[model samples]
Structures are given as structure tokens and as C-alpha cells.
Target: MSNSEITTHDPTSISRKSKKKKWSKPKKIWVSVLVVFLLFLGGAGTYAGFLYSKFDQTLNKISGSNGKTANAAFIPVATEPITILLMGIDARGDGETLNSDVIMPFTLNPITKSATLVSVPRDMEITFDGHSRKSNYVFPHYYIVDKEHAFPKTKEFWSNKLGIPIDYMVTVDFQGFREAIDVLGGIDVNVKMDMCYQDSTDGTNINLKAGQQHLDGAATLDYVRYRKSNCGTKESTDYDRNLRQQEVLDQLFSKLKSFDMVTKVTDILNVVGDNLETDISPDNLKQLILSYMNIDRGKINFIGLNGEWVSPFMVIPDEEWENAKRALKIERMRTAANPNPTIDPKTRLGTDMKSNYRSSGNNASSDSNSSKSQSSNKNTDASSKSKEKSSTGSGSKATPTPRSTNNLKSNSKSNSNQGSSGVEADDRVPKVD
Candidate 1:
């Protein structure tokens, strides 16, 4: 054979060429896959880092510029009990005085994974700064007087009233509340009654039918804030408002614990950063989330302190006040002893509101007697009305005594005309008359 033909038919060279071709194709494929995978990993890492940075920044903003790392009197530790005061500020109007109409003292026991929420009435009379005014006005009064020490003053006021350390304070404006709910795609609320109210001042027009329905931000606000209805519906008392607030909050908590919230964290953080203010440190806040993210909703007790409507003030009866204190104390003791404790729901300390405010109209009927007892109590002196004995007692069943005829007559007239203006008057500002 000729040399060229021999070279072409060489078995060794042919085998080598075939081997090279076979290896090169597979190698290119694997290299391409590896390059793509590395790019993906790098991109993921960058996104994660970005989220982390955003989270940190948002937390810092929520914590405010108080230069406080943790509570001065109480530091949140793992598996311990902590109390936080949540204040919902009513900032419906621009440059309007801020009033914390919704005041709830929340206690969380990490050991037992139980929580206690106590709602304070907005119109509850309290003495602060050498004057007697509604509790809701305290924050706004301080905010206008001493802007720098507003929160601190407010926290001190509530801590003394609740007789708890109150480790942290979280204040969220109405705008923030609305935005957060909207970001969560609204919430599910059982509307208790047909609500219809309108206000041209704040652009508020609330019309909601009673039913198991889905409420958006505006509707939810209207639901919680339906004090006086212009459409002949029954006016809502502070107690009713408190119950609605608790209901909305319970639903909100459930949504927060959902898997869907993971994707919406950034949006929530953005809203919170803009409108929410808290003294909780970023680290402890993160720790709280990690610890109680899966807390049982059934273990949470919602306690609303109801009392007789004495004009602008809702004077809590001695028995109801003491029962609330006992319930809160017992919750702390039970959780400290055991993670899960069997407690009766009728004791006012339980998760169910068997002894809720509305069902105990007898307590309201004895307003005169309760008021007398409250006035006589050494703790209820002019010097200090917030400090009372932490005594436990059964609800009072005293016979209904006649209230002041003049006061009742005047209050009745006021109630009938409360909705005439289409907006509830701010009690913080004194009338010019």
C-alpha cells in the first residue's frame, strides 16, 4: 500500500482521534453546566446579602434614634416573660394632635408560649402631669409639649397604670396600620354590626355590612373606628372598639405567621420602617421573631376591661379591675411553672371570653357603687389614681343605684347629638365654650 493510504488506515491514530472527540464534547457540556451553576450561586448570594442589609436598615429605623439598645429596666432573654405596650396612634389628619386611642398591654411568656393582651379604654380618665384627662390624650399632650420625651413619658404612664415593667413600647400610626394590612392583602374580620359613618374632614366614609367578610385597610380602619354611626346604627363604645381591635390583631398575627409572609417581608419592613416606632433593639426584635414565630393563637388571651360609661370616662369597677390584675398575674405564674397549663376560660384569665364585658351588664348597672368604692379607695386619691392593690375578687353583683340625674340627662343629650358633625370630636382639645 502507498504511504498516504497506510497513514489514513492506522488503527493507533484513528483510536486517538476518536478518543479526543468523545472526551471534548462531554467536557464542554459539563463546563457549561458548572459555569451556569456558579453564576446562579453568586446571584443568589448577592440577593440574600441585599435582603439582609435591607432587614438591618429597616429594623434600625423602627427602633428610632433613642440610642437605646435594650430596655433600661428589663432586657429580653430567651425563655423568659416580657411585656410590651402597643400604642396605636390616631393620626388621621395632617398636623393633627396624635392620640393613642388604642392602648394594649401585651405580655408574652416564652417559656409557656402564652400571651396576654389587655386593652385599655381610650376615654379612661387618668391623672398625669398634674391634670386629669383621658388616657388617650396623654401621648399627644406629651408629644406636643415635650417632643423629645414623649414616648418615655407615655411608657412611664402606662407602666405605672398596668403595674408591669413594660419592657418595650411600640407605637404605630394609623397610616402604618393601614399600609401593613394592605400589604398582607387585607384581613378576615367578622363584622359585628352594620356600620355607616362619613367625615369630610379626614375623607373618611365607612360603610360595612355585618357579616363574615374580608376587610381591606380602609374597611378595617372603619371597623375598629366606628364609634358613632350617622346612618341610625348603634354607636360603638370603647369596649366594642377594643374587642374589634383584638379580633383584627388576632387575625393579623395568624397572617404574620403564615408561609406567605416570608415573601412579603421586604414590603412589611418598608411599611414598618416608615410608620412604626419601637424601642426594641434590632437583635432582640429578631430574637423575638425567631422564638415566637409559631406561637399558638389559642394560648393568647384577649382581656378587655369594661366599665360604666360615665360621660367621657369609662370608670372600671373595682371587681373588674382586680380580676384583670389577677388574670395577668396568674398567667405569668402558670407559664413560669409549666409551658402548658389547664386554666378555666371563665376566670377572665382564659383564652375564651366567657366572662367578657358585654355579657356582664350587671357591672355597668353598679356604676354608682363602683365609683363610690373607687373614690373611697386609698389608692384612688387625687395624688395617684393609677396605683391600686393587686387584689383578686369576683365580679361585683351589687344592685344598680341611680346615677346622677343631671349627669345622665346631659350625657344622653350628648350621645344623641354625637354624630351630628359626622366626626367624633377630639377630647384632647377643650371646647371654646
Candidate 2:
């Protein structure tokens, strides 16, 4: 055979060709995969940058500044205990006075990874400007009188009253609360009883049935705001509302920490930007989120202030006030000398008292009802003692004097024709039914 015509069956050349053919497709596939992964990383980085920018802007708006500068005094550092006043304002319409329907003092201790929340009753009587008025009225009065220094004045008032140093303040109106809840697709809550209330003036209509149910934003507000049932249904007191607020907050936080929240970040940020206002600096706020992101829900303790109903006012007992103060102080203290410390159960003062107002499991409503009955009995006994003491003129302790119904009626009639900020008398105050 001719050398040129004969097939040069070189084993080495065939092996090289076979090797090239085998690896080419796989190499191309691997290169394609690497390119796709790089693209993905770039896209993710761009998205994250966008989110960070958006968060910065939102935080700036919330902190009431156009720049990145924050108040130096309000900055929260690593593992430090700080108190924040959470005020839920109720502003029905434009140009109307703002009332803080919810007054909560939240204390966070990053060292122990524990937090304490105390809900002060809106109707609790507080002395402001040398006159006694409901606690909720204090903020509105300050806002109306001095818009510029209203927040600072409010912080001062609460700090003095509670005997705790408040480091920052966060205010969210009803509209904001509703929108935030809606953004999270609603929250699961177990309504204690059938709530039916209607008010034509503010356009509030609360109608919720008893049981575990998923509530939308408006419904959740109703669940928290239902004071009295005009339709002869069961009535809920301020304490009951406080318990509900705590329950709703817990559920909302759980949802916020879930994986589903990642997709809704922008929406949530928008809602917060529009409705929420906080004094915490953007940097400190970020630090706070990072520090306590994985805090156990069980470590958070909620304390409700219970008191006797005196007509339109809730007169909190002296002992209860002292207990709340002690709990807050203890929570602010460092639990251990180490970096990571476990919260001692014995040091949690007001946690056991929390069960007196709020209960869990199937018989929650029943337990609550029983607590209410006991409270009523105590009030009756108190009333009897007050009358007896007044008649005999021989008691060392002074009973709280109930505001006269006639005076309240006259004040309301007078203020009815006035503007939103023209709440001169106690009649304009929201009364508990």
C-alpha cells in the first residue's frame, strides 16, 4: 500500500482527538455555568445596593432629617440597654389634634437578649399642667400647644411619670399601622369575644366575631380599638385592648422575621417611610436590627398596667406602678459578666403579674372574664370603703375622686362646636364607655 493512501492509524493522534471531543462539551457547559453565576452575583449586588439606598432614604425621612446625621445622644451601641417610647397616635383627619391611643415603654437589653414592654393605659389619669387628665391627652395637648417641642416634651412627661430614662421615641399613626399590617398580608389573632361598636363621628365601625382568625389591617385595628359594643355584645376594657396589642405585635414581628418578608421589603419600607417616625439615628437603627435580629420571642416580656376604673379615668394602683418601675429597672441591668448571658427567671419581676391580665391556651377568655369579675369585686369593695371613709372622715389614704358626669357633659357640648385643637376642657377627652 502507498504510504500517503494508507490510513495513518496513529494511536496517539486518535487518543488526542478523542480526548478533545470528550472535554469540549463539558468545558463549554462549565464556562456557561460560570458566566451565569457571575451574572447572578452582579444582579444580586445591584439589587442589594438598591435596597440599601432605599433603606437609607427611608430612615432619613423617619428620623426627620434630610441628611445622614443623627442625634448623638440617641445612638445605641453594642449590647447596651435602651428604652424606646412607642406611641400609637390616632389622628382621625387632617388638621385634627393627635392623641396617643397606645403608650408603650419598651426596654431592650442586648447583653441578656431580653426585652420588657409595659403598656400604659390610655385612660390612666396623669397630672399635666397642674390639672389631672387622661394619659393619652398629654401628647395631644403638647402637640397642640407647642408643635416644635411636642416630641421632646412628651418624652419628658413620660420619663418623669414612669421614672425611666427614655432614649428615643417612635410614633405611628392609625393609618400607618393599618397599612403596615396590610403590607404583611395581615396577622393571625384570636379575638377574645364578639366585638361590635359603631361611631358615626370618626367613622369607626368595629364588628369582629370571637375565635382564631386571620385579620386584615382595618379589622386588626378594630380588634384593638373595640372599647364598647353598642349592639349589646360584650365590652372590652383598656387592659383587654393592651393584651390584644401585645398579641398582635408578637404575630407581626414573627411575620417580619420570616423568609416571605424578603420579597416584601420595598413595600414594607414604603409603608414605614410614609407612616412611621422615629428618633433613632439610621446607623443605630441598623445596629439594633443586626444585634437583636435573632432574639427569642419567649425572652420578650409584656406587662400590662391594671387599675380601677373611676368613671372616665383609670386610676392605676401605687403598688402596680412600683412593680412596673422595678421590672423595667431590673431589665435594664446587665444579667451576667460574660458576653453571652442567660436571663434569670427570678429577676423578671412583672412577668408573673402579666398572667393576671393575659392568659394562654383554650380557656383564655374564661380566665380573662374571671379576672374581670375579680377586678369588679375589688372595685366594689374599694367603693364601699371609700364611702365609709368619707362618711366617717377617718381614713389615712385618700381615694381618687371620680370626674363628675355633669361636668364632662357640659365640657363636651362646649367643645363640640370648636376646632380640633380647641380641647380646652376635659369634656373633649375621649371617654371610656
Candidate 3:
């Protein structure tokens, strides 16, 4: 309106000024409204980010439901090696307490990435520091004797005995193990021989034939625990049963990684959170899970403890136990370096091929022809062989049993020629010295 006094007070100038004022007021209103709307949108976007962060935190907490996962706080021991004690507990009741039937300290060389399973027989007569009882009963005492500290102490004792530093302990109760197997739906195992056992006292009657079989929880337990029950006279022993356990473990692992296994694995994690006891730091656990997540099926090697069942001592000796430990250590080292290394031929055979031959009664002189002839004409052949050789047993020969082959095959070829000529039913484990 003040355009040089509106050109000396002109009427047209006054109308134009009035229209300009009206248009300017609306523009200002629109600019203010737009700025307010933009501010509101920015505030909402910030709020959404905050809410999403909170939601993510809640999900993580739930995922780490287990006290172990949540409570785990680890301080790295500088340059110190990490090891794990894997315990297979055998509990027959609903109680929380457990006594491990199989105790193996698995040492992992972080540098090598190899792992070894050193089996401790339940009946071993080692000194239990806190408990004044046999070594076998120490597992249950853990619940009463500081529950948290017992297993760790046991780990220490085993470490001292084997000269290794054990950093973790993973204990799985029988129910948990069976439940894990069930979660996998089932496992496929090669039964080395017919297992027929009749035990009226335990109310267990198991009859599993030789060859491969798909096993559920109950049957899987029987396959591993067949030693307690009656197996036929085909020379199938606890060693064979241990081999079956290894197979089942492999199958269970494969099933755990399958496409259909996600839901079941989630369920399993819930169960494991409730049941498993491990000193594995949450970070390490996560790392291990991530490292092994994409691993191929055959990369992992499952092995059994090679030892004898001593009825008198009720425990396996540490001699063979040590050998097994060494073999496992080497295996772990190899596996860590290369997850997909070419496993040896004998290692592929699940059972102990050396045992098959050493247990055979054929001597160095006993060729395949003689063995066949002796089997065909038992009485006549036995008399002739007895006269030819001082030792006598129908088709089977007798030799002074060596104290220990040290895993080296017996020099007597005939004595070592028993059962399929060192070939196992399923090749998965190699013969060791």
C-alpha cells in the first residue's frame, strides 16, 4: 500500500495492495502448517526407532532365558587354552540330582581347533576329594557338595590327571539326551550284531538285530546300554555298543541341521537351557554356534572309548584310556584346522577293526583255506591241528594272550585274522596303536 504513497492515493493501487495482503497471509499460514506437520513426522520417526530398540532388547533377553546364558560373564585367561568336559549322566529318577555314567573330558586346542573325548569309566577307583566314596558316585555328590563347584572340581582332577587345562563342563542328563534324540525325530545306526538280552530284574527286554536300524529314544538307549542286558554269543561287546553311540550322535547332529529341524531345535534349546550345565561363556557359545552352523554333515568325527569291562575292578584301565585320549586329541587338532579333511579309510568304519582281528582265534599258520577246512570238518581237523600245534580249540586256536598289543596288531597273522580280515561292518573309525 505504501508504493510512493500509493501513487498519490490512487483507488486501483489500494485494491491491488489489499489483494496482495490477502494472498501473503494465506501463504504464511500454509508455510507454518507445513513446518508443524514436518516436525510431527520427525518426532514420530525418532519414537519409532526408540521403540524398535526396546523391542530388540526384549527379544534378546527372552532368547537368553537360561540362567547360564544370562548369567555367564567371562574374563579371558590370556593365552591359556580352552577345554571342555562332556559328561553323559545316567539318572533313573525324576530328581534334579544326577550321577554321570560316562565322564569324558574333551580338551579343545583353540589354536588347532581340534577336540578330544577322554572317557572316564563310572567305576574308576580315582580319589573323590570331597566325597568319601568311589569315583563313580561323585556326580550325585555335586548336587549336595556345592552343586555348582563339584563338576568344575571334577574337571580339574581329570585335567591334572591328563595334563590339560579344562575350561568348561557340559553335562547332559539321560532324560535330556533322550529328549534331544526324540527332537531329531530319530537316528540311524548300524547295529553290528544281534542284541538279545533278557533281564527279569530290570524289566528290560531288548532284541535288536544286526544291520542298520532307525532308533527312537528307548531303543537308542538300549543300543548304547546293551552291555547291561543280554546280547548274543556273537562276541558283540560294550565296545560295539559304544560304536553305536557314536553313530547315533552323528545322525542326531545331521538331523539337527536339516530344514525341518528349526522348530524342533528351538524346542531343544528350551530343553537344553533347562537341563544342560556348561561353563561355556555365552560369547563362546554363540561363536561356536555360528562357526558350526554352516559346517558340512561329515565334518565332525564321533568316537568311542576303547577299553575293557573289568568285572572284578568294575572299571576300565587308563592305559587304553590314554591311547583313546591321544587319538581324540589328534583328531580334534586335524578337524579344527580343516573341518573337511579326508578321513582315513579305517576311521570311516564305525567299529574297531583291530578288535575284530585280534579277537579272532586264527593263527599265522591258519590260512583262509585251513579256516574253511577246519569249519567244515571240525572234529577231524581239530585233532590234526592239535597234534600239529600244542594249543587246541576246535576251529578256534589258542595262543598266549599278549598283555597288551599297545594297539599294534598281534604279530601272529593267524591270531589276528579273525572276523572279516580287519574290515568293519560300517567303516567310520580307524584302528589305533
Candidate 4:
């Protein structure tokens, strides 16, 4: 049962008058928040330093799987890519079981000004410390096991899964997402159909009419978060929900360009800061803004792992899961450094797996060097073959990307900024009876 279920008394029969009264306060709060967003845009450089000092206080540092500090994993070079894991958590202020409703490994290449954003389905299963569960719990479970070094353990599993290094991570709370959107005076989007749903237990009351219209923060939440629709025609399907999330993101950023962002930057920062936790330093944020801020919207790549699109939970294919990792630049194309002659060097995704894995399966960072030494005879022999890419002509470079028959789309034109406006944060009510 959801935490809301435990709290709300007779949710279905709750007063409609109360929900209407609730709307008045959020509108006022969002207006104030929107003013801050513009102020933030108007003078980012001037305030970046001051904000950095305060933002530094929010850092939740943890060592990487390779034993390097999270900050140490960054590669500022224009050519080399950097990866960031984005977590969208669904938990109100109360002490509910916090699950990652969304997980996206976002990659950026500074030189090419490109991005590869892979949204890992929350229902996809992943192995963590010999225990397999849905990937969404990877962090929350670790946070419970060892809060101080939770990220390290979680990062290790993903690192092995992807075959690439993750530089940083940012977690966004759902409430903050609502606040941010509401403050921006809601977002304008085209609605494909009428959406009406309510859940007393989860405190979700989503009811929006069909067609193009401006959605307030409350309506905006329903616009993106509603995966089940009463209007039928697969309105509530996961695939369509993902598309809606991306659409809201694209529209939100598109609207930012016309705003006068010089009134209240600090306030907006405060509103958002409280809801986020990340290891990315303030300096790095500034560096990204100055160097990689003007990212080409067209170049942003959306990645989805191939899986059995089972309702609510997707049984993702193994190699396709690995392919999603490579899209994040975790699994790199094999160079001469690889000793595993069985795998082809040009193959993408999980091509040249890992080198430092040992037979005992203890890839502990403390004994990383030793693990590599004992694995000299690892993997299948040279007889194993890998899938190869075909080119139209000779002298053409084979793209190292693995085969993925999944959804892929990029953001539309927008204001130049360092942040990836791909993922819309998540929070869902129980299925309406």
C-alpha cells in the first residue's frame, strides 16, 4: 500500500471542496518560484559563485567503483564524454519507501556537442550484490544498507553493467518538480486526449480535458505522470507516458527562452536546491554551463532498452540492457588495450566486457589491481563471434552503437543550457478502481 493509503481516511469520499481549496495556495507559491527562475537565467555568472558555496553544502559524496572520488571521474575535455545518472524519486515529505520511478544515464560529448540520454525503465531488473530486484531500488536499498557509501556500491553494479565510467549523479524529488513547473506558470502542450483519474490513497487527483492548452503545475503533473487514462485508446500506456514526459520537458525548456529571468534567481535556487541531492560540484556546474551549455537540441539522443513491454514491468533483454549502458558511454569500443581476442574490437555496447574481473567474483575496489591479475584466462575463447555493422561503402567508420529497436528522440529547439531537459520527474497514484 502507498503511504497515502495509510494516511488518507476514506479517500474516495473525501470532500471535493478541500481539493479546490488546495489549489489556491500552490498557484501563489509557483508564481514566486517562477520569478526566481528568470532571475537565475539573467545573471548566472554573477550568482554562480555565491550559489556554488551554498550548493556545495548539498553534496552527498561517495567514491566510485574504481575507487576514485566522484568528482575525480569527470573529464572536462571537449572530446571525451562525461556521464551523469539522473534519479527521479517518488516520495512525499513523509517517510515512505522511496523508489526511483525514473533512472536515466545521460551522456554528453563536449566536442561534438551531442548527448545520449537513456531512460532505464524502473521495472527492469538489475543485480545488486547477488540480490536481483527492480533497478529502481538500487539506490534506496543501498541508502538503507550503508548510507555513507551507498552510491559507491550502486555505482559499481551499474559500471559493470554498462562498461563505462559514471562521472556524477543528480537526484530530483517529485515535489520539487511540481514546484518548478508550477512556478513557470505551467507549460503549454498538446494533449492527445482527455485524462481523468483520481486516487484517494496516493493523494493523486488528475483530471484534464483533451486538446492543446496551458497546464498549471497541478495539471502539468497529471499531463506527464498520468500513465492510465479513462479516455481509452492506450492513453495510459507506459510507452505513451514516456513520450508525454519527454514532450513536457521539451516544451518547458522551449518556453524558458522568452522569460525575463532577472527578478528572483536566488529564490528559485532555494526552492529547487532543497529537493535535489548530487555529487556534482558547483565548479563543475559552472564549467558545464560555459563550455557545454549551447548543446545542439537536435543532437540529443534518446535511448530506450529493448524489453518485453509488459505492463508496469518490462522484461528487458540482456544484451539490449548492455546496449543501453554503452549508449551512456559506459561500455566503450574496444581498442588495442583489450586482451580478450574472442570479442571483436569494433562491436558496440557490451563488446569488450570487463578486464579486471576475477573468478571469485569479488571485484572490490580495495583489491581491484589483484582482481585484474587473476583474470588472465577469463572469458570464452577466440571462437566466439560478435555482431558486426555494415557500411554502404569502404573506408566508412562503423558506428559502435549496439542494435536497439527502442524509442529514440531528441529535444526540440530551445534556449542554450547545460542541463538536459529530457526526463520529466515521476510520482504516481495507485490504479484507480
Best by lDDT: 2
Over 4 Å off, model 4: 1-79, 129-132, 229-235, 262-264, 318-323, 330-433
Off by over 4 Å in 1: 1-74, 129-131, 335-426, 430-433
User: Candidate 4's C-alpha lDDT?
Assistant: 0.48
How accurate locally, in lDDT, is each candidate? 0.54, 0.57, 0.42, 0.48
Better model by TM-score: candidate 1 vs candidate 4: 1
Global local distance difference test of model 3: 0.42
Clashing pairs in 1: none
Candidate 2 has its poorest 10 consecutive residues by lDDT at 10-19
lDDT of 3 by residue, 1-27 (tens): 222221111100111011112222212
Clashing pairs in 2: none
**Residue range 8-119, candidate 1, lDDT tens digits:** 1110011101011212221222222222221222233333334444555544543353223322333554566777778887666553556677888877776776778889
Ranking according to lDDT, highest score first: 2, 1, 4, 3
Best TM-score goes to which candidate? 2
Answer with 1 or 2, whichever has the higher TM-score. Answer: 2
Task: Name the runs in model 3 displaced over 4 angstroms.
Answer: 1-81, 94-97, 109-113, 124-135, 196-205, 230-236, 270-273, 291-303, 314-319, 325-433
Q: Model 3 Cα RMSD, Å? A: 27.7
lDDT of 2 by residue, 1-433 (tens): 2323322111001110111122222122222222222122223333334444455554444334323322224444456787878888776744264667899998888777678999998887554432346778766665555544455556655654554666777777777678778988998887878999888887888889989999999999999878877899988889988998988887776665544554565465454432445555445655565456446677888999887665456667656676786777677765567523344534432212111111111221201122343443344446546555675686443322323333555534544443343222353343321
- Candidates' TM-scores? 0.64, 0.65, 0.54, 0.61
